[model samples]
Target: MALAIFDLDNTLLGGDSDHLWGEFIVEQRIVDPAVYKERNDAFFNDYLAGRLDIQIYLSFCLQPLAEHSAEQLVAWHAQFMREKIEPIMLPAARELIRKHRDAGDTLMIITATNRFITAPIARAFGIDILLATECEKADGRYTGHSTDIPCFRDGKVTRLDRWMLENSQSLDDSWFYSDSINDLPLLSLVDHPVAVDPDDKLRAHAEANGWQVLSLR
Candidate 1:
C-alpha cells in the first residue's frame, strides 16, 4: 500500500493550529496577552515569509507548558480543541483521508506543531502515525524545550528519513499533501505532491512544477 502523508496546519485544517494555540492561551490569560500576542503574531508572519527560527518559536510556545501543571494544560487543551479546532475542521479533508483509507493506504500526519497540541488532533482524524515536534518532559513535567530537530523545513525530510528507516517504509508511490512552501523538501520527495489550499509561494511553486493544486476549504 502507498503511504499517504498529510500536513496538519492549513493543509487539512482551515487554520494554523500552532498560531491558534498561541491565541487560545492569550485569551485564556495563560500568557501575557499583549506581549505574548505580539510575539506570536511576529513569529507567524516570519513563518509565512519562510524565515522562521523554529528553535526560538518552540521555546516561546513551550514555555507555557513549563509554567502550568500537566493536568491544567490537558484541561486547557480540551477546551481549546472544542473552541478553536473543531470549528476549523474541514469536511473536505476528512473525505480525502477516507479516500486514501479506502484505498488501503497507510495514513500519516507530519507537522511542525508540538505533539502536545497535535497528538489529539491526529487521533481525531483517525491517523495513528504522527511525526511532530516533541516537547521534552522531565519527571512527568514539561521542560519547555524540544528534544530533537524541529520537524520543519528541511528538518521534515530528516525526521521522515529516520522514521522510514525504523518502520521499513519507503517513499516509492507515496503521496504528500501540504499547504506551505516550507514543506517543499518533503513534498518533492513524494511520488504525488498535492498543494491543498496553498499559500501564495507554494501555489506558485506547485504551478511551476505541475503539481496538483486544490483547495480543501
Candidate 2:
C-alpha cells in the first residue's frame, strides 16, 4: 500500500501543537510561566525561521514529562486534548485525511514534536502510526531526553527511511503534506509533495518545484 504522511502542527491543525502545549502548561501552572513561556515563544519563532536548536528545544519541551508521573501526564493530556487540540481540529484537515483513508492509503503523522505530545493527537485523527521524536524512558518514567534522532529537518528523512526498511515499504507512491520548510527533506523524497498552509520559504520552494500548494485554513 502507498503512504500518506502528514505533519501535525500548522499543516493539519490551525495552530502549532508544540507551542500550544507549552502555553497550556503555563496556563495550567504546571510549569512556571515566568521561566518557560518566553523560551517557548523563542523556540517556536526559531522553528518558523528554520533555526531551532533541537536539543535545547527538546530539553525544555520534555522536562515536564520527566517531572510528572505517567498517570498525571495522561490526565493532563486528556484535558489538553479537550481544551487546546480539539477546538483547532480543522474540518478541512479531517476531510483531507478521510479522503486519503477512503483511498486505502497507509496514513501516518510524522512530526518533529515528541511522541509524548503528538501520539494522542495523531490517534484523535484516526492515525495509528506516528513517527515522532522519541522521549527516552527509564524505569517507566521519562528521562527528558530523546533516545534517537530528533525527527526535525534532515532527521525526518533518516527516520522515515529506517521505518520504511523495517516495514518493507517504500516512498515510490507516497504523499506528504506539511507546512514548514523544515520538512523539505522528506517532502522532496515523496512522489507527491503538498504544501499545506506552508510558510513563505516552503511556498516559494513548492512553487519552484511545481508541488501542489494547499491552504487547509
Candidate 3:
C-alpha cells in the first residue's frame, strides 16, 4: 500500500493562506478595512510562529462573514482561491502529485488551512478525503468557532495516526512532505520524512538527522 501525504501551503503552493484570506476579507468588504488590518497582522504573525489558537483565529476570520449566507461565503471563498491561488501552483508539484496518483498511491493533503478554505481546493483535485481544521456549525451555520481537533503540528500526527489505524495501514513505507519544523511530529511518524523547502528548524534537523531534503521551490 502507498500513502503520499502532502502539505498544502508552501510545499504545494508558494504562499500562505492566512495572508490571502485577509486580502479576501478586504476585497469582499466583509470587515472594516482599518480594523481588519490591526487584527489580521497579529493573527497572521502568531499563525506563522505556530502560536495562534485555532478557535480564536477561526472566530475572527468568520466574524465578518457571519451576516452573509454560508453558501454565498463558501462560493466566494472557492472562487477567490481558485482564481488567485490555483493558477500559481507550481507545475513540478502538480507533476509530483500526478505521478503518485498514476502509481495508485493514496493522496492525502494535510494542512493547517481550515476546511472552509482547503476543502474546495482538495475537491478540485478530486481529493475526497482530507485532514483540515473545521469551523463549528450551529443549526447549519458557522458559529465562528473551531471544533475539538485543531489540525496543526502535533494534532496532525495524532489525526494521521488514527487514520492509519482505521485504514489498517502502517507508516513503515509511507511518504510525507512538509516545510515547517512544526510538522516534525507528523514527519517523524512516517517512514519517509521529506523536508520540502524546509524552514530553518527543519533544515537543521534534516541535516543532523540525515533525512532526504527536497527543495523544489
Number of the top-ranking candidate, with TM-score as the measure? 1
Give the better candidate number (1 or 3) by TM-score.
Answer: 1
Q: Write candidate 1's Cα lDDT for 1-217 as tens digits.
A: 8999999999889999999999999999999999999999999999999999999999899999999889999999999999999999899999999999999999999999999999999998999999999999999899999999889999999999999999999998999999999999999999999999998999999999999998999
lDDT of 2 by residue, 72-146 (tens): 999999999999999999999999999999999999999999998899999899999999999999999998888
- Go through the candidates in order and give each one's C-alpha lDDT: 0.95, 0.94, 0.80
TM-score of 1: 0.99
Model 2 TM-score is: 0.98
Candidate 1 regions exceeding 4 Å error are: none
Clashes of each: 0, 0, 0
- Of candidate 3, the 10-residue stretch with the lowest lDDT total is 59-68
Models ranked on TM-score: 1, 2, 3
Cα-based lDDT at residue 167, candidate 1: 92
| Ranking, lDDT, top scorer first | 1, 2, 3
- The parts of candidate 2 lying over 4 Å away from their true place are none
- lDDT of model 2, residue 110: 96
Judged by lDDT against the true structure, how good is candidate 3?
A: 0.80
